[model samples]
Target chain A: MILLDDGCPDFAGEMGEKTGIDFNRCLQCKTCANGCPFIDGMDQAPNRIIRMIQFGMAEEVLKTSTIWVCVGCNTCSSACPMAIDIPALMDGLRHAALDRGVEIPEPDILNFHQEVLNTVKKYGRTHKLEIMMRYKLKKMDLFSDMGVGLKMLKKRKLDLTPSRVKDMKAIEKIFQEP
Target chain B: MKRSSRNLDPGPSSGKLKFSFFPGCSLKASGHENTLSLLKFCQSMDIDLVELEDWNCCGSSSAHSIDKRSAKYLPMRNLSLAPRGVPLLIACPSCLLRLKSSFLSIKADPALRRDYEDFFEKPFDDELEIIHFFEIFNRVDLKDHMEILAGTLKGIRVAPYYGCMLFMPPDLRYEKSHTGIIEKSLKSLGADIVSYGYANRCCGTYLSVAKPDIARKVVNEIIFKAMEAGAECLVTACSMCHLNLEIRCTLDNPIPVLHFSELLSMALGAEDHKKWFPRHIVDPVPLLKKRGLLA
Candidate 1:
């Protein structure tokens, strides 16, 4: 019982303006959908998502797991006949979803993103062990990758100590601005 | 202003080519081998890789997904700190993509450039070249060195995995296929380059963490494709790709995955191959020993 035209706003135009990718140039050739590795899991193929955006289906586009599932591999952008920056467009949608406070379908994915940012914000560089631990705690999936984590630790690949950059205040300021 | 790869000068005419090195996060953590091998390779070639002074995170995939401005500014901070006139050489392809895209984005828009300058308190210079470490192979004449090391890599059939970031969004890519330089270098080292279908395929990246099933599927396909083409090992430039290929590979017999730099350094007679090979999830030592590349 989803109404495509009832509350659909000019999502595509705003997104295009924000990301600088002209959705109008998409040839509907399915090249992007064909090349997407996650298309099978997607509710709508990438090409269809673009078409939905073009049709101003803001709610449908925003609510779908498409944005969250996209790994930002840039395969679609490379395959696009029109050379549209589809990966950038995907990033813009993720940002827009955050701005609108849309509930991301994949909470773990959302948590992972936030955890990575929090680690970077605190240390000014990503601490692999800290980031992974925080992400697991946030997602409460502690035991899933424990074995591999232990292996990484044993190999000394995941250092326990966090790297400290000199300009902590500057990094904090950059996060504060805009 | 599109920078053509051809216009890039090959090698440093001077005694040493000095540049700031940004190893990103993975280089210090999961991809320590890449850092070790790259440093060894640089030392052998008389290249000076001064580590960037107190470099911060480039925001990577996370910042770009949540906040657009932070994504641009975080990497911009690193670019700003990079020494003027000295190109910034980055080992991770993901870092290169973030830095290069931010550079292009700011250059395309003036107000955005002003905002970055105001935030960073430093003038944004578009002239600064962000070079990927793989591109350095293209610049150096490795023919003679390869001849010297040819015996080591003889009979090693390798599949060069370019992953996705090395060539994408048209401009950031060093070359269209992005595997030519790697393949050429491996060939020069006397290794057989296997023609595989998924050479440029996505390694499912962070998706391996977010969605393991999807990641496993993609990694399996790449692995099988390489094995089908008779490759004993998979050589890649990106750290993430190396991680994904190794971690998600559910193959019955997984092939050894080595960063292209690892193989290059090993071929160049790096004394401490043992230091880096242990870092690999899929041990490459057995294959190397079998081929008599390692004693």
Candidate 2:
């Protein structure tokens, strides 16, 4: 059996303060877990996460791969009986993890996040080929996917050339703005 | 096919169907053709649109991920500006959802709503409707009329991509019915709809900029899925999705990407194929010519 308190804050109290998650009204109906598509795969289901977070397990809460696996589909939040913003809460945890500089559970997850920002930072807008090439190089097994790329090329679905917008500065500004 | 016995055209009504048009930033820049075609289609069908006076980006997948308030505020400002009676008509589903979710969050908590409303000059009442462009096309009997236009779409297998928004959270649909609105809408225009699962898959959109490796993986999955589904070309409703899928082919062949309206305008015998043809990374002219639709 799981410890009820475990040196964490009340489930309902911390949720309202930190993540804007409304756990006080949770009916414990498990509707969210049932509707959550990712629940089966999750070690701690959405409801449990809310419960754990409510108990103030901030460190342990932010250190799991569960946050990354969330597709952010909002199905759980949509189905929550208490209308708990579970998806937003998950995002909150992700941000908290980043702020604390905690080691992410998966290496690929952080790389994916960094790659996205890099592309946006570089071109103001992402160039598909550049993003793909960078990703392949970083992953260190670029040629493993080369066959698929060649096939797509043969079918004329993947274009080698990329064209940038004339007002690239405007795009840059959007990203650069504080 | 449900054939319409009477004139399906919704005759002039007493009250105009008013909605704030949020043509997300990409449409203003690279998606001009798409915006134009959508405008033309709306006009051709006698639909009224009230575009927001000075709209900006919805802060897309990146801004929100980076900072929540900043991302939510951008869409919130637009939602606050939306006309009261009609639902806000958004061309981009991602923007629609973001705005809708923000609005939903506000309504669920009055204090937060008031707090944010104060952040804006004018106080918002949270009585706005955020709708996708697809919703307007499917409202009431729009699809029935669209079916009449379907006989024109005979050739060309179009891979209709839905990206990650249009049908997520499950409640945003206009008609509340089960139908492949995108594909069926195109089919009504006489295009062969390629059946595929990737139609609703994420284009690795947020990943496109934030996580290239994952973005590449996701995009490649979309491409392979579309090809395996037998699509001659891919048609999308999202510009971001278009960007990710279009520029990735770094070889001799590239799949041509076109907005749904670009294809429809071609089939409806409206747009100039030459001008639009050269602009696309993939050549849609041959396909159009093969169908004897292009001059």
Instruction: Provide TM-scores for the models.
Output: 0.92, 0.68
Encode model 1's per-residue lDDT on B53-113: one tens digit a residue: 8888899888989876678789989888987888899888889888887888788889989
lDDT by residue for model 2 (A1-178), tens: 3343444446435546667655556666788777654443356777777667657787777777677656566656556656666666777777777778898775555665555456544543334456557767787867865764554455443335543334445445444545
Error of 1 at B213 (Å): 1.4
lDDT of 2 by residue, B14-125 (tens): 4334455777655654455567777766655556666665454565554455455546565666666665666777787677777777787787788877877676657776
Which run of 10 residues does model 2 chain B get worst, by summed lDDT? B1-10
Which candidate achieves the best DockQ against the true structure?
1
Residue range A45-146, candidate 1, lDDT tens digits = 888888888788877888888888888888888878898877777888888888898878878778888888888888899887787898888787899967
List per-prediction Cα lDDT, in the order shown.
Answer: 0.81, 0.63
Q: Which structure among the candidates has the greatest lDDT?
A: 1
CA displacement after TM-score superposition, residue B89 of candidate 1 (Å): 0.7
Worst 10 residues of 1 chain A by lDDT: A1-10
